[model samples]
Target: MSSVPKALKYSKTHEWVREEDDTVIIGITDHAQTMLGDLVYVELPELEFSFEMGQECAVIESVKAAADIYCPISGEVVEINELLLDNPQLINEDPYGKGWLLRLRPFENDFKELLTAEQYTKLVASEAH
Candidate 1:
């Protein structure tokens, strides 16, 4: 079973978002890291870059495969996790914590489009079955 933090909002694509004032902290969900299998490299978008909702913003390469990281909402990138450059496996170790990817200032409060923990768990379960 994958770890799902109650405080975060999740996208179907497996990105998690934590709202902090006007900025949202983003990262791949535990389920995502498990599926990717041992992260090796992470390609992050430049700060100040703007992306539409569902736009591919980054790429995470693991021993099993490479996965695209999508923006959960339209936003401008504010910050990125530089530590991941040295330890990509932090995503596998603590996805919800030290593995966070970037921060974004959203265009709107459309976070409701994201899945809840219960919904995400069902989605993952269905995928497994």
Candidate 2:
């Protein structure tokens, strides 16, 4: 089963976000990494890159397939995980922790479109079929 931490918010594209102070941290869900299978490459966004919610911000290539990562909220990217450049498999080992992709200083606090843990659980369950 995929881990869906209750404290974080999720996107339909299978990304998760955790708000911290003025920024929101973004990463793929456990289900995403499992579907992709053994990530081999990660293309991270540049710092200070501005993006709208649902915009394509990064890419991940796994042994099975390549997937585009969408920004969960509108903001300017302030930080990216440098560790993933050499260790993309961190995403498979720890999807919610050290595998976090980027941090964005959001444009606003409107997170009405994000899903709760319960909602995401249902989403994953529906997709299982």
- Leading candidate by TM-score: 2
Backbone clash pairs for candidate 2 read none
lDDT (Cα, tens digit) per residue for candidate 1, span 1-129? 888888889999999999998899999999999888999999999999999999999999998898999999889999999999999999999999999999999999999899988898889999998
Q: Rate the local accuracy (lDDT) of all candidates.
A: 0.94, 0.95
Clashes of each: 0, 0
lDDT of 2: 0.95
| Quality of model 1 by C-alpha lDDT | 0.94
Clashes of 1: 0
* lDDT score of residue 21 within candidate 1: 89
Clashes of 2: 0
List model 2 lDDT by residue over 51-128, tens digit each. 999999999999889899999999999999999999999999999999999999999986889999999999999999
